[model samples]
Target chain A: MKTQSILLKQRPEKTPQNSDFEFKEEEVSTPKSNEVLLKSIYISVDPYLRGRMRDVESYIEPFQLNEPITSAIIAKVEKSEHENFKEGDYVLGHLAWKEYQVAKGENLRKVDPKQANLSAYLGILGMTGLTAYFGLTEIGAPKEGETVLVSGAAGAVGSTVGQIAKIYGCKTIGIAGSDEKIDLIKGKFNYDEGINYKTTDNMKEAISKAATNGIDVYYDNVGGEILDATLQNINRNGRVINCGAISQYNKDETATGPRVEGILIKKSVKMQGFTLQNDFGEKFNEGTKKLAQWLQEGKLNYEETIREGFEKVPQAFIDLFSGENKGKMVVKVAEE
Target chain B: MKTQSILLKQRPEKTPQNSDFEFKEEEVSTPKSNEVLLKSIYISVDPYLRGRMRDVESYIEPFQLNEPITSAIIAKVEKSEHENFKEGDYVLGHLAWKEYQVAKGENLRKVDPKQANLSAYLGILGMTGLTAYFGLTEIGAPKEGETVLVSGAAGAVGSTVGQIAKIYGCKTIGIAGSDEKIDLIKGKFNYDEGINYKTTDNMKEAISKAATNGIDVYYDNVGGEILDATLQNINRNGRVINCGAISQYNKDETATGPRVEGILIKKSVKMQGFTLQNDFGEKFNEGTKKLAQWLQEGKLNYEETIREGFEKVPQAFIDLFSGENKGKMVVKVAEE
Candidate 1:
C-alpha cells in the first residue's frame, strides 16, 4: 500500500513555516505475527509536538530529520496477526503521519465506536483528556469554592482544565486570544468568566475582576506575561500546574523571561512543570479510567478543530503555535 | 522605680546610624492585677527587625518614630501582682528595649534555668529556634540522604537549620561570610561542609562542590546572588524555604533581581517564603518544645554574640544588617 507521510525538512527558527515540512510517499508493509496494520483515521496535532521537532533534551526525544513525524492517532486495524486484535477493529496508538501503519498489537488499544465518537479517542478520551485530568486534580489540587485561572483556555488542555475545575465546584476563569474563543469558553466550555487578553490593556486588573476572591489554582498553558499576570493575583499557598508554555516555545531569547516572580515570595506559591510522560508508570491506568468515566457520564465536553487529509498534518501541528485551534487540533487521514 | 528605654528617633535611609535611636528614662508604673513587672536580662536583635524599621507592608507593623522599639526578650520578673508569676521567675516575652517592663502574668512563661542556660531562651529555645525548626521540618521537608544548603549559616536561625538537617540525616552545607564563621560551622556546628561566600569567586561552583549530590532543600536566609546560585544548582523538585532575605532588605531600588528563576521551571522547584509569625501558630509551640528537649539532651548547641548595656540594642540590631555577629546577636540589658 502507498502511504502519505509528512517529514521535517528543516529545523524551525521561531514560528514554523510550511516550507519546513515535506510530504512524501512511503510503501507500507504487511503485519507480522503479533503485529497489526492500521489505517490512520485521525491524527492529533498538539503544542507538545513542537518540542519534539527541536533537537533538545526534553521529556521525549526529538523527531529526527526526514523521518515521518509520529504522534497519538485514532485508527482502524485493517489487518491483524495478533491474538487480541482483529481486522476492522478501531484502536488508538502512537502512529506516524501516514495513511497506513504496521504497528505491534501491544502498542495499540481497542476502542468502541458505540461508547463515544471515534474522534473523541484523539482528544477528551485520550492523551489530551489524561493530561487535563491529572494536571488539575493531582498538581493544581483545586478545592471547593476556589478560583481557577487557566491560560490558553480555548485550547484543548486549557478548555478541559476549566471544565474540570467547574466539576470540582471551583470558579473557573479563562484567558484566550480571540473574542470568538472567549465566547466559546464562557458559553460552550462553561467557564464562569473569560478574558480576551489581546484586547485587555490591564491583564492584572482583568484577572482580579475574573477572580474576585483571588486565584487559588493556576493551570498555566501559555507562559510569559500571562503567567506573570496570574502570579500577581495568586492567593497564599496557591498551586501553579505548568502543563505547557506555548507562548515561549517559538520565541527568541528576549520573549522567554517571566517578570512577576516576586509574587512567589508574597504568596508562597508552588509552581510545578510536568509532562504526561512522567505519569506513565503504574498510576496511569487509574487516571485514564477516571477520565473515561467522566466522558461517559457527559460531565466532560471536547472539541476538535480537524483538517481533512494526511497532507495537512504538519500544517495542523503548526497551527497550535499560532493559536488557530479552538480545542484539540487533529488531522483526518482517512474516512472511518 | 525608674526605667530606661531606647526609642526609634528616626528611620534611616540605608544603613541605620546610632543617631536613629534616643535613650530616655521614665517612671515605672505599678503592675495592675494579673500583671508582672519584668527586668530584662537579654533582648534579641534579629534580621526581621530591619523590616520593622521600614514603613512597608510586611508580616509585622513598622515601629513608630520616637517610641520604644520592642522585640522578643528574656527577662526576670522583678515584681508581681498576679499568682501565675513570682519575683524570682525567669520568662520570655515580647518586651521593649527597656530595662524593665510591666506585662500581663499570662504573657510570661517560667523558664527552667537548670535545663539550659538562660541566654539560650533568646535563641535556641526562643523564636529563632522555632523559626528554624518549623521552616526546616514544615517547609524544607528534608529527607534522609538529601543535601541541605543553608545561607547565612553562622547566624542563629541558619546555625539551627544546619544542625537540624544533620539530625534528620541530611548532608548539610553551610554558607557564611567570614572564614572564622565558616570554620565555626564545620568545627562547632558539625556541618558536613562550609563555604565562605565572600572569598569565593564563583558561588555556583562553590555550591556545586559543597552540595555534590545537588541541593534538595535550601534554607534561604540570604536571598540575592546566593539564592540565584542555589537556584541554578538545585536538584529536581527541590524545596527552598525562604525564612529571610537579609541581603536585599537594606538595598535601595537598584538591587538586582534573581537571574536564575528559569531554573524553577527546569527543575520543577518549589520556593516558599514565610514569616514565623504567619505560619507558626500551632507549630511554634511544638517546635520550641522539641528544640528545648534537644538542648536539654545536649544534642543541639548554640552561641550568642552579646553586646553589653541596654543602650547597645539599636547598634546590635544595626550590626545584624552588616553581618557582624557570629551566632544569635543579643543585647545584654541586665544581669539575671
Candidate 2:
C-alpha cells in the first residue's frame, strides 16, 4: 500500500510558510501481529504543534527532521491482526498527517461512531475538550458569580473554556482577534461580553469594563499583550490557566512581555501551564465522560474549520497562526 | 506619655529614601479599659513593606500618605487592663513604628520569652518563619532528592526556604547578590551550592552547573533576570513559589522580561504567589508549632541584621532595598 504524509522540511523563523512542509509518498507493509492499520479520516491541527517543530525540548517531544508530524487523528481500522481492533472499526490514535498508518493496537483507542460524530473524536469529544475541562475546572476553578476572562476565545480550547465557565455560573468574557469571533463567542458560547482585540484601543480598559468585579479565572490561550492586560485586571487569588500561547508561537524575536512574578506577588495569582497529554493523563476517561454527557444533554457544542484532502494539512496548521479558523482546525484525510 | 514614631513623609517613586520618613514625638494617652501600652523592642523591616509604601493596590492595603508605617513588631507589655496580657509580658502585634503604642489587647499575641529568644519573635519564630514555611512546604512542595533553587538566599525568607528544603532531603542551591551572602548560604544554610548572581556573567550556565538535575522547586524572592534565568533551568512539572519580587521593588520603569507562559507550558511549571497574612492565616498555628519544634530540636537556625534605636528605622527600611541586610532586618526601639 502507498501512504501520503507531510514532513517538516525546514524550521521556519516566524510563522510557518508553505515551503516549510514537504509532501512525500511512501510504500507501507501490512500490519503484523498485535498491530492495526489506521486510515486517517480527520487529522487535528493545533497551536501546540508549533512548539514541536522548533527542535526545542517541551512537554511533547520535538518533531524529528524528515519524519512525518503526528497528532490526534480519527481513523478507520483497515486491517488488524489483533483481537482489540477489527477491519472497518473506527478508532482514534496519535497518527501521522497521512492517509494510512501502521500502528500498534495498544496505541489505538476504539471510538464508537454511535456515541458521537467520528470527527468529534478529534475535537470536543477528544483531547481538545479534555484540555478545556482540566485547564478550567482543575486549574482555573471558577466559582459561582465569579468572572472568567478567556483569551483567544474563539479557538478550540478557549470557546469550550468560556462555555464551561458559564456553566459554572461565572460571567464569561472573551477576547478574540476578529469581530466575527467576538459575535460567535457571545452568541454561541454564552459569553456575557466579548472584546475584539483587533479593534480595541485599550485591552486593559476593555477587560476592566467586562470584568467589573475583577477576573477570578483567566483562561489564557493567547499570550503577550493580552496576557499583560489580563494580569492587570485579575482579582486576588485569581487562577491563570496557561493552556496555550499562540500569539508567541511564531515570533522570531525573543519573547518579551510584562514581568509576571511581580503582578503575581501583588495579586497572589496562581498561574500554571500544562499540555493536555501529560497533566490530565489519568483523568482523560473522566473528562471524556463529562464532556460527552454535556454534549448529549445539549450543554456543549463545538465548531471545526476542516480542510479537505491530505495535502492541505500543512496549510490548515499554518492558518491557525493567522487566526483564520473559528474553532478547532482539522484536516480531513480520507472518507470514513 | 511621649511616643516617638516614624511617619511616611513622601511616597517613593522607586527605592525609598531616608527623607521619605519623618520622626515625630507625640503625646499618647494611657490605655483605658481593654487597651494595653506596648513598648517596641524588635521591629520587622521587610521588602514587602516597600510595596505597601507605594500608593497601589496589592495583597495588603497600601500605607496611607502620612500615616505611621506598621508591621510585625515584638514589644514589651508595659501596662494592661485585659486579663489576657500583663505588665512585663512579651507580645507580638501589628503595631506602628513607634517606641510606645497604646493598642487593644485583642490585637496582640503573647510570646513566651522562655520558649525562644525575645528577638526570635520578630523573625524565625514569627511571620518571616511562617512565610518561609507556607511558601515552601505548601507551594514549593520540594520532594526528596529534588533540586530546590532559592533566589535571595541570604534574606529572611530565602535562607529559611533553603534550610527547609534541606530538611526535606532535597539538594539546595542558593543564588544571591554578594560573595558574602553566597558564603553565608553555603556554610550556614547547608546549601549544596551557591551562585553569586552579581559575579556570574551567565546565570543560565551557573544554574545549569549547580542544578545538574535541573531545578524542581524555585523559591523566588528576587524576581527579574534571576527569574528569567531560573525559568530556563526548570525541570518538567517544576513548582515556582512566588514569595516576593524584591529586585523589581524599586524599578521606576515598567518591568519586562522573557515571557514566561511559553516556558511554563513547555515545562508544565506552576507559579503561585501569596502573602502570609491572607493565604496562611489559619495555618499559622500549625506552621508556628512545626517551626518552633524544629528550633527547639536544634535543627533550625536564623540570622538577624539588627539596627538599634528608633531613629534608625527609616534607614533600616532603606537598607532593605540596597540588599545590605543578610537575614531578617529588624529595628530595636528599646531595651528588652
Candidate number achieving the greatest DockQ relative to the actual structure: 2
Candidate 1 structure quality by residue, lDDT tens digits, A1-336? 888778888889988889989888889899999999999998888877777788865446899999888888898989899999998999998888788879999988899999888888878877788888888998788999999999989988889999999999999999999999999999889999999999999999999988989899999888777877787788887888877878777865344333233445545667766657664345678877887887778778787797998778778888788798889888887898
RMSD, every candidate, angstroms: 3.1, 1.2
lDDT of each: 0.84, 0.89
Candidate 2 residue spans exceeding 4 A from truth: none
Cα-based lDDT at residue A8, candidate 2:
88
Off by over 4 Å in 1: A8-10, A22-24, A27-30, A63-68, A252-262, A279-282, B8-12, B17-24, B65-67, B252-262
Error of 2 at B44 (Å): 1.4
After TM-score superposition, the amount by which residue A57's alpha carbon in candidate 2 deviates from its true location, in angstroms, is 1.5
User: What are the per-residue Cα lDDT tens digits for candidate 2 across A15-43?
Assistant: 99989988899987789999988888989
Task: State the TM-score of the second chain for every model.
Answer: 0.96, 0.98
lDDT of model number 2: 0.89
The collision pairs in model 1 are none
Q: In terms of TM-score, how similar is model 2 to the real structure?
A: 0.98
